[model samples]
Target: KVALQFEEDWKERVYDRRYVALAHGELPKSQGTVSSYLKDDSHYVTHSSQEDNGGKFAVTHYKKLKSGNGYSLVELQLETGRKNQIRVHLQDLGCPVVGDLKYGDGSDPIGRLGLHAYKLCFKHPVTGEDLKFTSDIPKAFSAVVEAI
Candidate 1:
């Protein structure tokens, strides 16, 4: 039997500032890391902009990889995985993922969530060996990125 462990590498997301502007949300003027605290109450996970809040500590780092007309292709790394961590953090950044109805402005430019896990790495549970897996970006995602 194989016991898989989660070791986050990075995720590809499309951040669209247009949505934030349309929704009257504040947009982050800078990009680097987000160390916001989060709390999961089953129904929803909320975040406190403060660092010392009594919520579960979550950290996500992001950088702009490419720019589009009104959006950008971003690479994100999660230091601490939590429920809806990426989505929540993106929302906090005011550049929610395109096609993310729950977090963004209900846009579906790709007809699916604009989030993809392209790589995963883990250690073998029994042999303690390192293993890694990778996959190509979906055609739909690629097309959208290309068009944007």
Candidate 2:
């Protein structure tokens, strides 16, 4: 496995992150933002309920990429990286990532979590050079997305 390194100044740079997820259904809008307070109250799940109290702020912007057969492919950009932020926020929207049994309806169409980091960009800590990385979405994900 490849380990990702983060610098102390990472928060100062725009870390553009993107992921591909299979949602249970279509979202209310093609593109929108989800913001909430998230707390890790359980080892198996994250809580987004306001009553959880004094949780960390988290935000994610998502866009619907494709939809068919009771599922939709969504691209997400996270503004904060709180633990389980995406899963919790998406679940709050009532469309958790497919195969994410911890947060969603527990449907495993592809036999694994339908979440993948597709791209990441940020400034290099030492070189001060702009760096970017992109990864092709898994074939299983692409197949489902294109089938729509």
Candidate 3:
């Protein structure tokens, strides 16, 4: 996954995290590696923030949810330009993009990730209409909203 940290230049860093099921109790003694530590592993999977954290999922735009379920903000301009980049990234972090059981949270109540691309504000590519649109948080996100 590709993520940019908060610092000078804001150079983006990319990691290739994948699903590796541990054999029985083989989970890492440390929840994650030091590299992931610098990237905030524990909460990275959740829809929260990466304000000084270090872990695998470093790209911050739509962070893990930190509190009562409500909505999530997503900026797709940085999409890795790959199929399932977002879903793969979030799943790698352990927090499958909510309703996307194929990625992170498989225990979906309604269906789909508890996340959404709630806002889309930009100027028309040609018309320059300063178009802006927003979508309500998916109801699936609400059923487990309080979990976060």
How many clashes (backbone N, Cα, C below 3 Å) per candidate?
0, 0, 23
lDDT of 2 at 22: 81
How should the candidates be ordered by TM-score, best one leading? 2, 1, 3
Segments of candidate 2 deviating more than 4 angstroms = 1-6, 42-44, 50-52, 145-148
**Deviation of model 1 at 142, angstroms:** 3.6
TM-score of each: 0.73, 0.87, 0.44
Candidate 1 C-alpha lDDT tens digits along 54-95: 688888777665554466566666777766777788788777
lDDT of model 3, residue 8:
26
What clash pairs does model 2 have? none
Best by TM-score: 2
Candidate 1 segments whose C-alpha is farther than 4 A from its true place: 1-31
Model 3: lDDT to the true structure:
0.36
Look at candidate 1 and give me any clashing residue pairs. none
Q: For candidate 2, write residues 36-130 as lDDT tens digits.
A: 88777657467886553678888899999887777778889988888888888778888888898788999788889999998988877656688
Q: Write the per-residue lDDT of candidate 3 for residues 77-105, one digit (tens) a residue.
A: 33222334455544444444445644454
Task: Please give the lDDT score at residue 147 for candidate 1.
Answer: 73
Ranking by lDDT: 2, 1, 3
